[model samples]
Target chain A: MTETRGEPDVEAWAESGGRERAAWIGWVTFAARLGLAGVLFWAGWTKFTEPVVLQRQAVDAYQILPEALVGPVGVGLPVLEMVLALLLVVGFATRLTAVISGVLMALFIAGIASAWARGLAIDCGCFGGGGPVAEGETKYLQEIVRDVGFLALAVWITVFAPGRLAVDRKLGL
Target chain B: MGKASRERSARERIAEQRKLEARRDKQVKTLAVAGGALALIAVAVGVVVMADAGKDEPAYTGPLAPTSRQDDGSVVMAKEGVTAPVLEVYEDFQCPACKGLEESSGNTIKQLAAEGKVKVVYRPFRLFGQDPLKGNSERAANAALCAPGDNWIKFHDRLFAEQPKEGKVGFENADLISWAADYGVSGAAFESCVNNGEKGAQVQAMTDHAFNTAGVQSTPTIVLNGKNVTDQAWSGDDLAKAVQEAS
Candidate 1:
């Protein structure tokens, strides 16, 4: 009312035509970072709530890791996931965390693909914890696709951890 | 346009540049310190989980408990002259989760039996009724039935250790006989018994009794004192605790 550009926000409008586009991009990255964090948090929390044996058995179903390594990975992976989610939520070292998140999702995709290729009828015991094995329904493709989506979101945050409300922005990261 | 104005503008530009460099420095320092702290926390959690996850079941090697095969093809191992609660294990060798359950709780069950705290009855059956997985389960269950009484538990443990990937062909008859031979259980009779599928009928009967009569629809099921406690017992520690509470 005092003396606008006959518009609501005069300062931003006067700056450059690209400012609005850049602002949109920032908001998009912000949404992505938080979305990825929420999914990771849910993934980690679900594992925490399930019986440890279910996770252990799920990891064993992959049959990739050595017998000695399976137990520790199954036990530690969810906790690490939760910590990473917390970091992503706070945007602390966001690019680094997103890279890690992307890598984790990539590994999951690879494991699922390998299982599918080998005709292993076993199900992955992660994410939601493999429920009872349903005959003739591995659903490997669906799992891989969902993980790919998560991977995309992680890549978004890695490329542009925007200055919306992130701690990284405050620290000039 | 004078020299003083130009110099003042130059000074302002330099100040702005300096502020940017200072902000970048702060970002680097903050990131390094915070990232290092996170890495430490992750590593600490990993080490602790590893310590907790990979616990070995103390193998009971003190003495041999008398084991006998019941008419239903179930092997019962209980020290004679000791009356204790019965802990029944219903498992299929080809079931992946069954292998996990055995790995996690097998030694505990054996120890309980060896200590005469519980009577262990291993009921190996074919949980898989479909092909791919079905054949392996049937062969392994039949082979288990053919194992001699004294070393039956050893044979049982060996089968679990040698389990193949789900839907894979495994527990071939020759390997079954060889495995028995390693346990000092080999002979022409044992080989013929395994090759000819002599215990196939027994295995089939046991599977039926387990699924239909015993109401076991899943592998790696635990029955302690005639009550299914599989929901509560997932590890050696869990097994030990549940048995203590029940018995």
Candidate 2:
């Protein structure tokens, strides 16, 4: 099959530098995929048990979105997070999921930044239960930094496709 | 290049095209299945959420009195003697700042109310439901409204006095019942009302009023004659002075 089929380009590439590079990329991809999956899983799972109420409060506290948008965002965000987590964990449509994950992280970073700039004294509500932070307990800087770190992981996964053990690769994405 | 090699390359190109098409087919199939699964999960979650949104709250049949309810169903803590110039004090039961505001100026406000100087209406405003405190503010507010007649004020004051510390459970049903008893607001009817959460709707309605209608962002927002006095620290004689000025 190897002789009959058209894979000389792959063979030649493998012979040159592709084998070592692919192996390196695979390990990095695996680690990045698992890392982001763990984050989304933890974040989404925390809110799932409690359901929509606190999530709504968190959304309201941002004070950025319109009233009409609040209910849908509050109800839908955690579900999306969990769905994205599942996709990331199983490495299905890895590039698409990773891009989404990156977008979410970027949004979180922006939200926290805006809240901090506005002197809102909010809890970032990244995992859940976000509203006005308890008095004198504002941690906006730390929240922003952590979200930035998550954003970096997401960006890496987006670019590299996380091909190792990924359903995307199996489907030749 | 030789003819044999050229032919082999052409054949390889055809095979590559076939492989690419097969890969695309697989990808399309995977995306379709994944999208369907995601939609199914989303629909399931939406249904569950919608079902929970339907409150099992029993009707507020506990007690009835001559209390004035605002447009949004928030009860106005209306006294008989005072008629004009409503002194609206927006407060949350669990908010520490509100507790402070009440502690500092509660007496002055009560004295003014007794004197019929200003009709003080304690509007229930909630915050901190999403935190570890959960829905305690809303629950306490509900319990306050559920208190029979003039007993709501007493219940309101006592709640602030025994207001739990920040980042803690503010009040449970049993605690509310016991406190109501302490404030001479006890009975089987009242207990049933609190337990059954009959006034939960009223509580939610009032909270929405404070947030949406009144544009109340935080607790302890003091308004006299519809003028906001939230910026001023009316800690001492200033509170009485402000009330007097409003009149």
Candidate 3:
């Protein structure tokens, strides 16, 4: 009787193009969530394990914050990134986390752009170990492009957050 | 439509609206709690860090011994003609571990020098080979050179107090000049000396001598009576013992 309408195992379900498209979209979003989580975890863990002295230096390389703010921002950013990654892993408040992650990526892109504009040849410190690079070694374009790719993934998760195996779906979020 | 059927449909729509409201409320509450938790954790960590970093040294107000600038861009502080153990402290302004050494042993060394118990030689050198870190070390060393012998010690302490993070542009000429004023070491001559980098070559020579000739390859390398007592002189208490044992 259920097959008369549209059983998942039957041909009737294949007739709906919208369902197929949505299934594909769900899979892509799920992949983005994990990919974003992996990148964020790595970024956070690298800085967390490094000495605070180095992290402070890396933050100073940005040259955006005041000297007074440098210590706190340097110390806090890594932990916050890890927390966001955990939240993504559990798929709780995923859309919100993606939006926050996207904003962070945008800020990073802006900082790199500002540094490039100011003629400073410092490393972006995305994964830690920031400072002056050797001559002809500043990869401003590459850093920006990579961050933009992350931003795109973030956007995808923000739009399609209720993907497969997400806690959001289990909770009816 | 019949009244009974219309009434039933209206009731169903109301129930659906309530269910949607409940879901929205739950999502908002969940997000709010999560965001709040994240913020609390971050702020707590920041506070802990700030508290730890804010322990600055009180200014040394005791009698300072006579200081003489050596030809090799080093400042020696000791009683005139007093033959005592030489505590040659090799430091770089940009190095954090050097800052640690200053925090631990700086006061003890000053006290020993004041008491004529030891001949303390403050040798600031460029440990970093690259810019902008190398640049910071050189500038701070040059600024120390510009300060007259006794003032150089104060400049040394001041540089450590506000030691910038590595990989940053620090020890700007203006800041260098201003720091000297804190110890009455300011004048047009001093300002011009800092701005023109008058002791730039001397700093380079000192760095070369420190690295290439002295064979010292790290910051906070304290050579006591020609013996490296750095490990023994880790703290003020340890430094005093080391100095006494060496004597």
Candidate 4:
């Protein structure tokens, strides 16, 4: 006696292409986010363990935003990085997390670029002790450019993917 | 069944479907927003931590006479000079870890030097002895030998301070010259030594001697009181103890 749109038209819903497109985008986003998160998490952990070394390098490069903000940033960055990394791996808030990651990567690239431009011969301090350089050397432009590319990928994830396999999707959002 | 009854049933079914869809949508949106907020907060925390890290700059409070050359290439000593145990270290200009040791432990060494507990004499060794032209090690060594009176220590410090981490060649002549100028060394003299390879043979002989006679196999090999302690893992304290014992 009642018409119910024939089980919500499963074939039609699947054929609209949104689901397929989202799947593809979601997978790509997952890979990129996971990769970036892992790298940042490693780097952040190293720095957190050796805050003194990182702080010294940062000051040497003159990358600190302001003289006053240095101490707090050093202490808080590692915990933050670990949390974000866990979120990304778990596919929690994938799009938003990707965007944040992209922004952070962009900031890092900018910092490296500025240091290179200024000829501050110091390590990037992205990773902890005994970096690619022995010490007292600036990161090259090539490394910064590579980061820019990664940042672009992250931004792509933010725009196209909606974290299909994430908690959001599980919640039916 | 009556037509009205059928119509009423259809309306009820439609309402139930709409309600379910609305609930699902709400759940998804909430999850998305909440997860996103958590990630953003993590990023925010990371940025803040990095920012705060810049505050604890290591201070060089050692009692070394802060020596810097004036514009006219005159050496100026900040504190009264003292007699100390002597330790001569021969190093290459382009060696990366040399730079690290210098930045990390240079002040501590200087403090020891200033206190008359130790004296550090840096002998330059050219690791890139194969390429005589662009070899930073040879050029730096030559410059130091040519202008030892004015630029030896300062030039030594600057070289480690500005050495490139890794590359095809070492610092260019221009960079070396500028660095020499920073220490009040005569740029012309530094350039000429670098160009002519003034201390090429001496540096080679010293490096060879270090290997053959002193068994020094590393850039940071330390000579404690004329005895080559190359094999031992020598720290500042170790050197201090050796010096005290020798004295």
Best by DockQ: 1
Docking quality of model 2: it rates as incorrect
Q: DockQ (Cα-based) per candidate?
A: 0.34, 0.05, 0.20, 0.22
Candidate 1, superposed: residue stretches over 4 Å from native: A1-31, A48-54, A66-68, A128-135, A162-165, A170-172, B1-6, B9-13, B37-41
Candidate 4 residue-wise lDDT, B188-240, digit = tens: 66678876777667776766766687676666666767887532312344455
What's the number of clashes in each of the models? 0, 0, 0, 19
- Full-model lDDT for every candidate: 0.79, 0.71, 0.80, 0.60
Native contacts recovered, each model: 0.34, 0.05, 0.10, 0.38
User: What is the C-alpha local distance difference test score of candidate 2?
Assistant: 0.71
**lDDT tens digits, residues A33-81, model 4?**
6777788789778776662434444433444466356446545656666
Please give the TM-score for the first chain of candidate 3. 0.88
- Screening candidate 3 with a backbone cut-off below 3 angstroms (N, C-alpha, C), the clashing residue pairs are none
**Model 1: how far residue B41 lies from native, Å:** 5.2
Sorted on TM-score, best first, the list reads 1, 3, 2, 4
lDDT of 3 at B154: 70
Ranking of candidates on lDDT, top first: 3, 1, 2, 4
Q: Which candidate leads in TM-score?
A: 1
Point out where model 2 deviates above 4 Å.
A1-17, B1-247
TM-score of chain B of each: 0.89, 0.67, 0.74, 0.60
Candidate 2 lDDT over residue span A1-173, tens digit each: 55553345543443355678877767787798888888887887776654344566677677789967766677677777887878887788676788888999999889889877776767877787676666568998888889889889887776666458877667555
Question: What does candidate 3's lDDT look like per residue over A51-91, in tens digits?
Answer: 55567777877778997988777777887788788777777
- TM-scores of chain A across the candidates, in order, are 0.85, 0.86, 0.88, 0.75
Best by lDDT: 3
lDDT of each residue in B1-247, candidate 2, tens digit only: 9999999999999999999999888778768756765675578557655764552222223322235555554556545756766788888887655765665566666666666677777787666656555467877877887776555666777888777644556688999999899868788888888888888778777777888888888776888777788645235356677877877
